[model samples]
Target chain A: MSDDWSAEVEELRLRRRDAMALGGAEAVAKHHERGRLTIRERVTRLVDTDSFKEVGTLTGQGRYDGATLKGVTPAPYVMGLASIDGRPVAVGGEDFTIRGGSSWSGDRKKGGQGGFIEDLAASYRIPLVNLIDGSGGSVTSINKRGHSIFPGVHGFERSVELLGKVPVVSAVLGTAAGGPAGRAILSHWSVMVDGTSHVFAAGPPVVERSLGQKIGKEDLGGTQIAVDLAGTIDNRVDSEEACFAELRRFLSYMPSNVWEAPPEVACTDPVDRCDEELLSTVPKDRRKPYNMRKLIGHIVDNGSVFEIQPTYGKALITCLARMNGKVVGIVANNPMVYGGAMDVKAARKQIHFVEMCDCFHIPLIFLVDVPGFMVGRDAEAAATLRDGMRAVYVGLQATVPTYTVVIRKCYGMAGMGTTEKNGLEFKIAWPSAEWGSLPIEGGVAAAFRRELANAPDAKAREREIEAELRAMASPFRTAEAFGVEEIVDPRETRPYLCRFIDAAQARIRTSLGPKAKYGVRP
Target chain B: MAAIQVKADVAGSVWQITTKVGQKIEAGETIMIIESMKMEIPVIAEQDGTIDKFMVDEKTAISEGQVLAVLTR
Candidate 1:
């Protein structure tokens, strides 16, 4: 045999060059013309510089002239290990330039739905970032496999398990349907770029055939339907670069895995940096709604708040923020939307946010101003009461330390959910806080109905009873009786909650690991 | 020119119309105030635009997402 093995080595170099081409120049140019990034470019943009340790690069279909290989076409998916923010992550995405990034099966599966990427995240207990672009499970697969395959052969069992153990993030970078769309929903947090991305159960072709209605892809499952209306996607960004930035920001708040506590950073915003405007933030006239977002900005660590599902539930605001450098979840009621009442949508939003915070062992800060569960025929028809109660049920079951700050109105079962009744049962209030079973204005009308109906001046007598009840409903009286734990000025909210959150880290660290939730929600 | 549909954020009755048709309005300026659940919620213009038309008059009952006005930027 010849001592030189240069021929085989040269063949290997050519094969690697074919894989680097990534579906060739023309197809990649088409993808770029559509305002989307290729999988290779996306991976480069998302991960730390030169940190991608790519696996399965040599997987492709080879064309040979009697054992002398001409070239190879790479697989439609690319995946491997990478680091984000100097922390390890299993990153992968579908190569859309290759046959619209459809499923490509090699000798062994690579990633996307119960594959090596998910397995890597599970075994190593690190975060998994999925850049989903493929339209999953084409009918062409049946011709190749020579049979109509059963559903979920490459199932989501691993994806489901990863949600419980590690932080799973998905980004829909293209028009995703079927299996790919389902995978996007399995993440702890998911995002899609506006205009360039869309996700749905089926694309417009399937929808038109099933329903006999022609519709555009954007109309069916763009950010409006996916993020704002349905809340199927958690966040939407203007571009892919912004999407990547937000993904990094989201992971910064999360622990690498549930077994570890959420990472905290040093705080430059002082604990005692109380804004004087906090005192006048809530208006003296309660009917005139004030800016709750402005109020939140005044309290938390400066520039540390990241809102989740901001447009979907207009009544409630859920944010991941820092308090004295410790990561905290803020669930504040918006006074501008139905007086911050807990409607069906707001209830669903609360349940998800509360459960996520509890799972990650992040303490909660509830800035309450809810009057009660929403009222009206529309609310009743929508089963708002049931959903509202389920939110309360989930809140009661949460073991994380919750610091309730009653800013203004707190009434009924919706109000009761804000307190950490299961744990400390401690609640603090602002001097402006007022609490009761129901607001006295309406309660008096129902309780003293017949009395007021028979009075010489029913409206005047009703006002008198309301006045009497309002005097007794003062927060000071509640504090005097120890009904509430403490009453502080609005400016003291940051320092007060920060001190308690720092102290409760000891309790939070002890309870790390998967939280096994029990009982069916009401 | 782009026509923007300014929708109601809540189901409520229009309390007051703060702008007129054919008038210029800045982004973040209140176009109308809605009375809902004993609170006044302002319907704001999200972009700087000239008022195209009022979709609903003051005191009209409107549902969430009902167009309150049209603006041409």
Candidate 2:
């Protein structure tokens, strides 16, 4: 009995030692202070309630300096497989208390679990969710620049390569700066907690030393800057709890990847249930902006619009939505972002989303208010034209049943392609919808720049030009040229687009080809 | 002087002409902007060129491999 008791005491002592080594009280205190959940907490939230199968929970070191405690387990991150909503998914999260979740495998010894988890994800064809947080290769610790920088332990590049095979999703729950942020960048979809999470190539300390800018952490990688300015990330959430909710919403519709179609949900909204408000939801003026998203929500099946790359392209909003219980791709514009200006970034986003939906044989319901392409010197530097043109090429080449409804401002490239090719398919436009080579304001600026500038009465002449262009930009004007198929009442948009999707879905198998390829990003 | 094929990044129809046939242009000069999605996309010259070969005329459709122009220095 004494011998058995001693062994039990020793095991308990080692477990206590392991926890202490990973930062022990310090890490717990820090987690509480920041209102951030621990790695275990995050993993539970990601997987179905109590469905997580943790592989290496007791692997972190509890030593002060290193996990060299002979008998202690050494791991900085938790790696395992869990089923989200009953489908298997591979997930990983950093234990920040353990040396700030630094990656120091020292030649694959400490970081082998991450590799094992990735292999399971790739082999199983399940979705991979990386609740990634922390930096790579700790320089300050270890006998010689520490364990995180060792060879054969880097797991990021492989993740990027394996993106298309399986649906990869990431949520930046904390300050996921540096190498960790790159993982999130390569995902099919990524969400960031606005106040809790930040993504950047480096932290403020590095920036302060390198650029001589002592910026705050928020400035370094805030949600607004990443979501709004850079246009690199997808969505920004109000809190960590909301981030998980967004993740559930995204994973609900998508399967693993292109190999499997989005899971069908039992939708209750009537297939013919039409929202008549769409008729007047858009502004008549080509230069004015309106809420295209609201109209999309009302038309799609109840709570069915799953917008991908929502933050990347404001000019074009691409989503996988459902109508009458059938999945469809929604490509619309958020005029709030760039006056619905389709730029290079928007082009990349639109083309990728279009290609994915096409491969999956999903019908496309393109909500058009696209104000052509972005303009001026800045647009030139961005190669906006290059990207936008590629989008046009993809849209034309796509074989899915494309139904377009011209909401309000469907001028330029957006106007022509948003509808079926010269009325090749069903295209309905509202009376308020306008189509032209350019917005009258921009057209007058370019064709008669000097004339408009030199006019004796500039403002009044501008108004007159606006009126003339408004007359020229009407949907009636476009329909007269056989550009638009039929001009319908705006209130009937939901019913019209729904019928078009039904027509398109029945004809998917006949048009499958290499052109119908999958992409890792949208 | 060597020539590089200035291929369009995407397939689209050429719409606006921003350069002349015989213009001595520096690298990254706007050759012509293609119109797609109601947006004007400019095909910039990567190197200096005399616009020696204007393969695509304005309002003409060009695919990805259908060269827009060739730059010869």
Candidate 2 stretches with Cα past 4 Å from truth are A1-25, A57-73, A106-114, A140-157, A283-288, A306-320, A335-338, A343-362, A393-401, A414-426, A440-482, A506-522, B1-73
Q: Candidate 1, which CAPRI tier?
A: medium
Q: Per-residue lDDT for A256-374 in model 1, tens only?
A: 99999999999999999889999998888878888899999999999999999999888999999999999999999999898899988899899889988988888999999999998
Looking at model 2, give its docking quality level.
incorrect
Model 2, residue A129: displacement in angstroms? Answer: 0.6
Query: Distance (Å) between predicted and true CA of A229, model 2?
Result: 2.6
Q: For this target, which candidate reaches the highest DockQ against the unseen true structure?
A: 1
Highest TM-score among the candidates is held by which one? 1
RMSD for each model, in Å, please? 1.6, 14.5
Per-residue accuracy of model 1 over B1-73 as CA lDDT, tens digit each: 9999998878889999988889999998889899988888878778999999999988899998888899998
